[model samples]
Target: MAAMKSTLSDAARQVAANALQNTLVDLLGLSLIGKQIHWNVVGSRFRSVHLQLDELVTEVREAADQVAERAATLGVPPDGCPATIASAIALPVPQADWVRDDEAIEIVTEALHIAATRLRKRIEATENSDPVTQDLLISVTAELEKQHWMFASGHAAHAQ
Candidate 1:
């Protein structure tokens, strides 16, 4: 059997792999939560929130693919299996069968906050080990932060 070799030193590859794997888990988990709320959301703001959820899911899914490919580029296999994500994901699971639009916004905002926070840490982790991977993480973090702000601001608008 042949093995993929990474150009990075062992330590650098390890660091990049850890950051990429964790980021993949978070991205996948966020997409799942976004879709859940997309389907279950109800209220005056349902249409807008549903559409926004699709946007969020699309962004995260693309980010996940990039992270996974980055990991493979580093010769580290990305584990995005349901079982792996189930065990590693840190995002809160939605408990309600039907969530109000306001509540959905709050939930999604909170999830994005968690994802962005972890992504910031991953960004820091990869900065010294791999600048190329670090750049990707930075871009992903920016998008997650944007989504977080939008959801949070939407909730505030509804509260007004």
Candidate 2:
């Protein structure tokens, strides 16, 4: 089959492809982490954290889809395979089979913050190379930041 063509110049295409691929991996990893926490979280705050994890997983999955599609649109093959994500994901790993609700909050909050920070770098990398991809990264970063704030804030509320 003929390779798909992209409107972007070689350098620009490379930049956007790299950014999108990395972002996709992180998003997919975040979704997995959220689901893990949702299933294993315990304590009196379990119900609330579980529900929030579901919402976070939904948002992360949606963002991953968007990032992967954007890569395809740019004529880059998006690799979201488990192996790729496992190798590329920079997010924290769960230490145990079960986590306290507050601990889950801390873990997810830190993960989101880390993902958002990496996204900001991707946003900058794509700024001059491909503003369209940069825009998508910016939006994804915003949502991640929002989720991070929510998790952090909720944890604080519980502490008070």
Candidate 3:
């Protein structure tokens, strides 16, 4: 068997940086989605959902910062203004107005689930080339997925 390569190159690092920039874009996307869900949630679970919204956004915002910093570490500036995020994100169409509590939660759950899945793949890619980065993406993905399931099931229960 051939011996493993010594390490990634500067060009490889730049490629990693580009991927990191993409991750940062998703981070901004996810954070904004969380904030939107929190802002628009309604229904019988008002207090619970609304209260949890703040926590969701708080965590997502932190994750966004972490991803941005990771991009910085890789020498790529994270380009994530609201417009950029809106342009880049490929999530479902969100309602401009507040949705029924269940709809709001469901939309958010799906979006988070998608983000988590995407992040997991990005994490794996960065794992070999950049361990420090892989760690943050892994942690963020796990948390988002857990939250996704929680909200998804809750939304479903409300419908039943």
TM-score against truth, every candidate: 0.96, 0.97, 0.85
Q: Note the clash tally of each candidate.
A: 0, 0, 0
Clash count, predicted structure 2: 0
Give the deviation of candidate 1 from the true structure as CA RMSD. Answer: 1.3
Which 10 successive residues of model 1 have the least lDDT summed?
Answer: 1-10
Residue ranges of candidate 2 with Cα displaced over 4 Å:
none
Write the residue-wise lDDT of candidate 3 on 1-160 in tens digits.
1123325566666666766777777767766776777777777888888877677778778887887876665656677787887888877646678866777787778778777878878887877777777787788888788888778877788779
List the lowest-lDDT window of 10 residues for candidate 3. 1-10
Q: Supply the TM-score for candidate 3.
A: 0.85
Q: Write the per-residue lDDT of candidate 1 for residues 44-159, one digit (tens) a residue.
A: 98899999999999999999999999999888989999999989989987875999888899889989999999999989988989999999999999999999989998888878
Full-model lDDT for every candidate: 0.92, 0.93, 0.74
Model 2: per-residue Cα lDDT at residue 136: 98
lDDT of 2 by residue, 10-94 (tens): 9999999999999999999999999988999999988999999999999999999999999999888899999998888899968
- Using alpha carbons, what is the TM-score of model 2? 0.97
